[model samples]
Target: MPIAHIHVLAGHPRPVLKQLLREASAAFAQALDAPPERLQVWITEVDPELYAIAGEPADEVLARTPRAQAEIPLIRMALMEGRSTETLHRVMAALSATTARVLGGDPQRVRVQIDHVHPDRWAIGGVPASQARAAELARRAAGQGG
Candidate 1:
């Protein structure tokens, strides 16, 4: 499963945010080989006073540069480590494009943080994901798991 945490200054319409979530899920499904249903997306709307850019609050930044109001979304993605650098790079590119399309976000202003966690550091149920993943891989190789 891939978990995405997105933060943006509060203002965009709910429809836009919904579209963004939809697009982001699709992007993850395609780029990470994760099932769409298994993807986890969390959007956090931050007040302009709480979100700062370049040492200035978002509101101040926007007041100083009106044209940049729609450009400051930040996306953070966490996934199990093991994927190749090339794959991660592609995921970031796809996500950035999807975000830009949904919100008309500026490519330069959009920020993405991808965190790859070791399987041993994560868990599902009571078992470490490293063990579960190993078993799953074994089963898949034996044609017993999907």
Candidate 2:
């Protein structure tokens, strides 16, 4: 499951958060080739002036008419194995683009991080617990097994 925690200072409308949740969930589902029901997302609106911008303080960013700063930390995890680096890169691009478009953030300043996950984090349809990170860990462990 993918959970995007958008920790921005409180002040934004509720619809915005809802929209974010929808977009994030869809993005993750498509990115991992999973069904929409298989994804989960969370939007956390932090207090204003909590997150900083650039090297300066976030209060400065809040001083603007928007009066709110948003820090979108998105994490999409999938049990699928064998995703190429290029594929991951494109996913990042699409995610960032969509987030920027939806949330009205500076695309240049936006950031997105991708990770391979263990499916165990989710027990789909009462399936047994599993680790989405299993294969990745195994690969890394074997690489360093020596």
Candidate 3:
């Protein structure tokens, strides 16, 4: 399973935010070679007055600079910890590209952080994933030929 949490400065239109959710979900699914239904993505908008850049309030930054140039969305993702480094890199690049495109910001400014968790540490319905989804994990491992 893959879960992505996107944090952006408040001000973007609702439609843009919705597009980000849809596009990002597709990107993650495609890059992970996983079904769309297995992925989860959500966005949290932060008030500009509450966020800062270089010790300056983001509201002040936005007042002087264009929103596209001033805004930098931070994306954090959590996934099971068995993917190869190459696969992780691909996922990061895909997410960065998607965030930049949907948010109208430079791809280089997008921030992506991934946290890999062992199955024993992840849970579903109060049961550790290691035990609750062992068969599914086995099938995925087999499909990946790992």
Candidate 4:
């Protein structure tokens, strides 16, 4: 499972927020080989006055550079450990690409951070994720999709 926490300056309309969630989930599902059913997304909107860039508040930045608003989406993703470095890099790139496509931001400005946690530290239904991962791998090895 992967959880993406998106932070943005407050005051986007509902539709934009909805699209962010939808598009980000699809990006993770496709890029990380995870099912959408296991993807969790959370959006946190910070007050413009509380967010700053290069020592200026969001409103000040916007006043100085209108395009700064489109560059404000910050995403933090948490995933299970044990994935290869190539997989992580691919997912990060895909996430940035999808975010730019969905939000019309400059791809260079899309910020993404991924944190990998040991599966033994995560659990579902009292079973550690490492155990679940083993089972899932066995299923895959046996020609059953996990």
Name the best candidate (by lDDT). Answer: 3
Model 4 collision count: 0
TM-score of every model versus the real structure:
0.86, 0.63, 0.95, 0.86
State which candidate, 2 or 3, has the greater TM-score.
Answer: 3
lDDT of 2 by residue, 1-146 (tens): 44444444566678976787788678766765555774666656665456655654666666764541334444343433345576577667766666666777655545665555545545546653355345544764465320
Better of 1 and 2 by TM-score: 1
lDDT score, candidate 2:
0.57
lDDT of 3 by residue, 1-146 (tens): 68999999999999999999999999999898888997999999999999998889999999999988888899999999888788899999999999999888999999999999999999899899999989888987776531
Model 1 lDDT per residue over 47-142, tens place: 888877777777777776753454477889998766668778888888878887787766677788999887788888877887977876565457
Among all candidates shown, the one with the greatest TM-score: 3
Clashing residue pair totals per candidate (backbone < 3 A)? 0, 13, 0, 0
Provide the lowest-lDDT 10-residue window in model 2.
68-77
Backbone clash pairs for candidate 1 read: none
Which pairs of residues have clashing backbones in candidate 4? none
Which portions of model 2 show Cα errors greater than 4 Å?
65-82, 118-146
RMSD (Å) of each candidate, 1 decimal: 2.8, 6.9, 1.5, 2.5
